[model samples]
Target: MRKNEYTKNYDITIVGGGLAGKLMLAVLINCGVFDQDKLCWINTDNENFKDVRVSFINYKNFIKLKKRIQLDVYSKDYSVIEKIELHNTNEKYPLKLKDLNNHGIIIRNDILKQNIKFSEKKIDIYRSKVISTKCDEFNRYLFLKDGTKIKSALVISADGSLSPLRELCKIKYLNNNLNHTIITGYLECKNFNNSTAKQIFLKDNFIGLLPLNDEKNLINFVWSIDNKILDTNKINFHEKIIQMLNKFFLKNNLIFDSPKSKDDKFKRVQTYPINVKFVNIPFKERIILIGDAAHTIHPLAGQGFNLSIEDCFDMVKCLKNAKIIGKDFGTLSLLKTYNNIRKTRKNFITLATTLIFYVFSKKNNQLNNIINYGIEKIEKTSLKEIFKFLAKGY
Candidate 1:
């Protein structure tokens, strides 16, 4: 790889081959909106994050992505969640949230990451890291670490939260430290069925329990712990978690069962820090940021993957519209259209997640108040149906 070898392929170069990049590439290749020769993928692989053991994508999004993109093996790597239950430390019992005419899906992150590699696509692949970028009116030059320079009409920066291309583009972004970290893993239990997904907002942390299988009896647990608590006790945290969870259930008069056998235990444990980042505009010039490069919200709401999916899906739609009209998809006006379409939704989600985290983190009368209000509204008004409609994208 000599620096003199500057010639490279490029019509649209996607930088970052993680889920979002791979996903968009899959759609673009399958949909034939652009010629296969016009598309190239840079950094065709990424670190396999073991911390994200399982991820939840709502049923609506799942079906839409699968149908629209003809996703690679999407149906094979997931388990269904027939129902959802929500609980707060202040509440006596869990409140069941009505499904939006369909259920949700829990995907094994490893399986999906392993299977959706876009191996069949014939586009040019660059495993080199993007070292520098130069933008002009018609083309953007991407300098790679391996001495290959690509000139792309459009560049997609899906390289993740700390995106090198984003930095190179001089895109200003805001970062909000959540002051929390999540410990995610699997816990095997014999008594529980995999029909329901549950979330509990505790004082110092929030816990999400997603059943992995109906017959195998395993639950994927995502525990968001306060930094202070996590820093104070670095030993035997999972053991204490079980005890604390059982006590919460008992005190709330909720039926609970603890795993009694060695076969039924916590395993595959991992922890990671949490933060939220956002850019006001997801695009600058002809380079666009998708997935974590554009934004990363609180994971408590399970909106991370969904938002990324929307980013990819909407991007394709924008390009498709451009293709239909015989317009340049890499133009600034087109990028603005894409940014405008995605901005408000990202803002709303970011605000909502931050607000929810604030309310739950305080654990004051606010928790009880929300629970009571929710119960009353569900019983007395049509708020329940309204929420269902919202969930279903009405």
Candidate 2:
């Protein structure tokens, strides 16, 4: 038992083995605060991680990290999203936001995992569940289901939305339930261009077509269904998509039958209600929450994953600063620095998505006029660069 105790102790312990947690581990490795024995990862072994969902990666931020810290996130496997075209009902002008640097990439979850996992092989990995946690002033202790206790000076929770570590810290969130159900699935289309993604605003909800590959045939689709329009449990995705698009999008692109072989990944579908939340402060005592544990946003912008990456990088920055001063990085005072930065970013992103969602959902003449003015301002003025920065994280 003494040997077990010695093996389990660490300077930092990170929970949640998802992309956020792994990214945190990778950045911390780059920060050079702790070596192999001092840092550890606790994976939620219960999850097989259904990786059908795709994410919008801000390549500028990723490439910055890749260049500075040697992350392998940029490669030929990703599909570039050079432009985003937004459309609405009744002769609406598509709001076009262009990135001159081509800073956005739409990549599935699994490939992204491969890109970030290269440097994490040196750390101690625990494939167990954290059942309970206790903390003193200098260190937090995690009791795992696998009969081990981990003592760490700092605990970073990159766990999922329902983070057990956040609950233990007693952090509260600002909540907004959009009351819309989103259906995500792959669509096989004829001559689907992977360079430009499109969003169509219908009378009720919006549809997002995110490019998936260079072949230009497969696209990841996010269709939000207003609760009043249909039951979430009873969605027949392909038929409903055909019905939804034939009215507004027929001439723009053609969607064909998705490949439905058992091995065909495109046939998988995931449905979840849209809810947005943000923590006022995502840190307490010696623990900090990053990624989905810290905030949730409307998926229209596809900024959630990129925001998570920003969170991890910022947390590492705080830790590195604290280390340079020979101070405890786990202290609540030091963590407040990270808290302020991420909260501001989280607020700005959440509010932007909320505005876009509101303008589309409300569908009033006033809101329509407001969006039109905003889009025109973006196109005609230098605000276009700022808009691109906000959308693509340049």
Candidate 3:
């Protein structure tokens, strides 16, 4: 048996250093829960992140974070989205989402990672992998690969979809691959303003173009198509997509100017298999899962990241209350409250998005017409409610 050569203790240990994890750390630091030295963050590697990954934060969620955390340090650098335009294959008129108060802000993941400069001074960040975990009645312990161990009163797992700590807890869950492929990349565009987030629904695929910065010269594009159409040869896929988009824009009388070139390059075209996953219960013993670790949903509604943001805020609230009441912050009562609040919203969002995919994916002409008509009616009559739901995530 090995002796404990190095042992450290913290009030809270955060596993995973993704956006959600960082937001939690920032909140803890801002809320004055514990000094930076009293908290620990265990991450495998901080340098292995993509600068291209992005998310759209609803106005309400943005305000919430900005008011609580020091988000202004980096959030103001992104593009503010004022409108959302949705298109269908059969119609020339698009469904427009423009709310004066409930808009979205486009932000890059890299910027968010960099904005945490303020918190770097306080938290004990370990750049090592968690080899295993051990827990007792009162505290939880993490074993790192470098033969170091750390203990904490509460452990938060924001470790993305494939969380090792979640596995160690033996938490039963449901995971299903939808057999769809999502191709995401950045593209240069002309005749586009940075005020709108657009999604065009075609017969076989859905394309989302989000403004990356204020100039709107570059767009972050995500295309969700059938998995079978993915070609590994990389043969003129970029050209074909540009041509198709220009044609669609012309049909809709939208300005889509492209410079005629003999060779055009696409940056970082990556494919991911779409999946729906969530745990049955979010906590085991002293550990609680949040963000993607607890639930993941389809991108059809662009609510995955927003939901994760909300998760952080809600968790902070619950933990603060637990502290105020002088109760063990890691108690089952506190965790159950967090799980109940998140799971209810998660279920509602999952059902809504799944039904939407079903309705839009149907190939029957009559069903398509009916769905389009329904959407148009909703847009005209209840558009504000829709925008509110998307913005506030109720």
Q: Of the candidates shown, which would achieve the greatest TM-score relative to the real structure? A: 2
Prediction 3 global C-alpha lDDT = 0.75
Off by over 4 Å in 3: 1-6, 48-50, 73-76, 214-216, 231-235, 253-266
Tens digits of lDDT, candidate 2, 1-394:
6525735557789998888898888788876675667888998644555586888778677676666567565556678878888777754467787776775788888777766743656777888888888888779888888877888889999887778878777888877888898888877666667888888788777889887774547778898878888654475788778677666766666645565445556687788877887788788778888888888887888888889988887888788888788887688887888888777778888888888788789878777677777776667888777657677673
Candidate whose lDDT is highest: 2
Q: What is the Cα-based lDDT of residue 285 in candidate 3?
A: 87
TM-score of each: 0.89, 0.91, 0.90
- lDDT value for candidate 2? 0.78
Which of the predicted structures, 1 or 2, would earn the higher TM-score when compared with the native?
Answer: 2
Clashes of each: 0, 0, 1
Stretches of candidate 1 above 4 Å error?
1-3, 44-52, 72-77, 115-121, 251-266, 365-380, 385-394
Give per-residue lDDT, candidate 3, residue 27. Answer: 78
User: Lowest lDDT 10-mer window, candidate 3?
Assistant: 257-266
> Candidate 3 on 248-319: residue-level lDDT in tens?
888545544333333233355666778878677979988998888887777767788788888888888898
lDDT of 3 at 318: 90
